[model samples]
Target: MNYSKIMFMIMIMLTTLMTISSTNWIGMWIGMEMNLMSFIPFINKNKNLKSSRAMMMYFLAQSIGSIIFLFAILMNSFIMTPIMMNEFIKTAMVIGMAIKLGMAPFHSWMPEMMSNINWNEMMVLMTWQKVAPLYTLSNLMNNWSMYILIILSTIVGAIGGLNQTSMRKIMAYSSINHMGWITAMMITQTKWFMYLLIYSITVAMLCYMMNMHNTYFINQVSTMNESMTEKLTYSILMLSIGGMPPFLGFLPKWMAIQSMINTEMMILMTIMIMMSLLTLFYYMRMISSLMLMYSSMNKWMKYKSPNTMMVSLMLTINMSMPIYSIMSFF
Candidate 1:
């Protein structure tokens, strides 16, 4: 492992933690700025033009968000009435953080940026980068506005990916879809941290598997003549990612649905379920392509085994919930 890269990532997480733990807006802004700077160095480290473009877009988006946040903080300091100041501040903060979180209307940058980077960077972008902004939004934004954003994100994520063929772009939409669920859970004050934890781990496992197999596009899976075991392994991964029943991925979705129903958000839950089904359609499409090839293969080559660590992590992700549930009785 590269110690310097690991250290930079640690700093990134530390700064996000700093933002979340800060008491004042200025402290939080400073922490977020630190986090942003640390992250810029980590993106597009390969010196390619596409990666550079992605980094630039990410920087501009983040910088614009920071400016808006700081302006809101400054304006709030001068306003005499708490009521007026709170309104302006909340509006500005929500818009700013929405852009940072790549919530829809401000979400186009995400798929474009994801397209330029590799799976590892995409994993970080999808999961860890969401921590501070999302938590901050949960703490500060009004429930009504958050709900609206949640619906918009789910709708956009579902529709936008319908025509996409790239794996990273598909994952980008998937992240947006999951964001809607995450926001809904946060709005309901459900166990959002638990949701985030499982989401991050599942995304990490999927990205790791994708990285190992050098699979970058949906077409690549169907075109590359892979072993039956390889095809089957990835098929299960795709199913798990789509939140099929009995998989670890389904656990969080089930929890969120239960929470939504309990809150009498039946209509919202119905829309979310329908949109989630749209995402699953493409996931199944990808898996079917692989399965079709798997069924026709003539002779299987003896495979190079996966890394022990990779297999262990995959098993842990797939089995962690079931094992925990079993252990609960003891």
Candidate 2:
């Protein structure tokens, strides 16, 4: 909310746009570097030990990725003789983007960093910071290795959060899982942007509610002195985020599934769907704790209702299926 943070946020957005719109690799690299610089301030905005550590880890990971990205670009521009070398450079570029985006195998830092930050910063990290690298990776996703990464990311993401107590870490792993679906979208070259848009909205909603409540862990949810309606609202949002049917979050997955089926990627599609169920299982576990498990409540504690804006947004997202079905009828 401060002027300096606002300025940096604007810079981040502008640089992401620059990277996505750039015609060449060097320009994209510069844009990514600028975005990184703009975001660093947010990482340490709290000036605590955890934030400091997160900032350091984030900086190191991004710096290494940027260096490899730049080196690969230079090699591609200067040494274009052999086909094998060209393929190697391409793979290197993909690896660089993967590290930057926190794809599987390069993803260990994401959950650790996210768990250390506040929800607001984690929202940006989970959503906006991903744009440039994901765009770049989509361009380099023609190889078989990228498919392997898709599988690894989905599997790792689905399983990694099973034991997590921290809500932020759970969201981090969920983002990684969604990244697999998004990356897979690149293969079909279909509605990846739609998927990202719906994902951003869902994540922003969840983070906003968590930050408002100052909720950080799974245990906190069950202990909150909330009304049944409020708990039900939260449960619906969680299910939506897990891509349950009749919610806005499920729309993009439906599109992606249709595209995969059309392309005859049955095996990959089946794996992704199964892994997605694992994600839903954890979400349901959290919801059960939220709605079913009750702690002794203080009689004087007041239950707060969600704001009108949040309520309206929730209604809109939940109604998406019927809206889409009606539209399809026309």
Candidate 3:
């Protein structure tokens, strides 16, 4: 890349380091803010007015929720207790964090924002950045509101993602869906971190591949003629997102649910499994659209390999995570 790109990556790296190092909630929140601001410049690098507008809304939404986070911190401190507090402030703070993370009920901006952002930026948005806020919150409090909020997030994330047509939007929903799964697993932090690590690896690899393929616009892939290899690639990617057994996505969710089931959360597990149908169908839409073989007039008729060394490594990661997790567990 260019100097600008190098500087941007450095900005993100430092922000990530800042997040992991912050000892307190406010410090962590500020680190997240720094990360958010540092990354905004990259969101709409094409300088498209659409990207700009979406970025503005995203920044505003994150900022507003952050204000509440700060406010809750102030109130929690005023209550003459350090981190522990009563239900009202606790719930408010949890909701505020949820909103920042784009969990449902507060998720209106996410799909809209995703529709406009590039996947490289979307990469950072999805993985390392996400783990920070979540880990921070889990470290701060282990309370009932967090559990309820996490469950609600999983429900909204899985269901809300059903009707998406844009690739970014689909991935956005996927991010939210993982957010829910991670949230549910957060109740038992140590075990959930394993889930999170597997999740971040799979998602990062998948989204990176999507970006490299320039699968930025869903219409571009769906409405255009797709080559056999492209179609096969798309099919594999979609199945992975749907959490098929062979793909990486399957491992974390499966592990987390098995953990939940062990604790007798059958109802919640049922809800999560059922809502997954929503994601499954939509993911299949991409597969079906790509499954159409290339015709003379198809856009992807000239398909050359997008397979770099990275794609090979990513594919290996995707195919290997589940098998390893299963073998290690059982």
Candidate 4:
């Protein structure tokens, strides 16, 4: 809300644009470094110890990634390389991006960081902060190592969220899982940008609603003094986020799956599908807690009316499938 925060946000967007638009690795690396600097201040805006810690962790992780990235860029730029050295450079580049993007195996920092930040910060961190690294990674050659990273990311993301009670942590792991899918889109060279756009919108909506209600943990869902309609709406949104059919979130995944099938990536497709089901299970668990569990019946408790804009957004997400189907007929 303050000018300083607004400035940092603009810097974040500008830096991401710079990275994605750059023609060479060095330019992209500079953009990434600026983006990191901008985000650190944004993350620490609250001036609390928790936010400070998260900021430091993010800085350290990104610094390491950027160093590796810079080293690879310099190696590829200056040194005349043989086939083996070229492959080594490529591998280093991928690892650097993976670390920065918090892809699995380098992903422990993400959930830990997200769990410490507020919902708004979490939204930015999960969505916009990922653009530069993901775009960079996508432009790299698709190789065997990428497939291994994809499988590991999907597996770790799905399994990691199963036991998490913190909403932020759950979303963090969900982001990792979705990152796997997005990376697959890159390999297939399908609609990765489209997928990323849809993901950003979905995450923004979910974070908005969660922040509005000040909801953090799964248990809080059951205890909220909300009407049945409101609770049901929230549950539906969660299901949509879990990529349930006929929801907006499912559209991109459906497209990705079709692309994978067309490309004959049967093994990877199967694993992703199974992991998706696992994600859906935990989402359903949260929904069930909201709808089925009995809460304390306190007549004096004040009930906040649901935002009309948020309700409209929810309706749009829920009805996207039907809309798409109707459009396809045209």
Note the Cα lDDT for every prediction shown: 0.81, 0.85, 0.72, 0.86
How are the candidates ranked when ordered by lDDT, highest leading? 4, 2, 1, 3
* Residue 100 shift from truth in candidate 2, angstroms: 0.7
Clashing residue pairs, backbone N/CA/C < 3 A, model 1: none
User: Distance from true position, residue 68, model 2, in Å?
Assistant: 1.5
Candidate 3's residue-wise lDDT over 1-330, tens digit each? 578867876887788688889776677778878877877777767777888987898899889888887888788765644455777777777777788888877888888887777777777777766766776667646667766766677677777767766778888887787777777777744577777777666666667667656776656676544454445555666777677777877877777788887778788778878777777877877666566544554453354565644555555666675568668868
Q: Which one is best on lDDT?
A: 4
Off by over 4 Å in 4: 79-85, 294-306
How well does candidate 4 score on lDDT at residue 36? Answer: 98
* Ranking 2 against 3 by TM-score, winner: 2
- Residues forming the 10-long window of minimal summed lDDT in candidate 3: 293-302
Give every collision pair in model 3: none
TM-score of decoy 3: 0.86
lDDT of 4: 0.86
Each prediction's TM-score versus the true structure: 0.90, 0.93, 0.86, 0.93
Candidate 3 C-alpha error for residue 30, in Å: 2.3
Q: Across residues 227-329, which tens digit of lDDT does each residue of candidate 2 receive?
A: 5445666787888889898877888898889888988999999999999999998888887887667556433224445464575566567657768857977
- Model 2, residue 328: distance off in Å is 3.7
Candidate 1: stretches off by over 4 Å: 1-4, 78-85, 225-227, 294-301, 304-309, 312-316, 319-330
Worst 10 residues of 1 by lDDT: 293-302
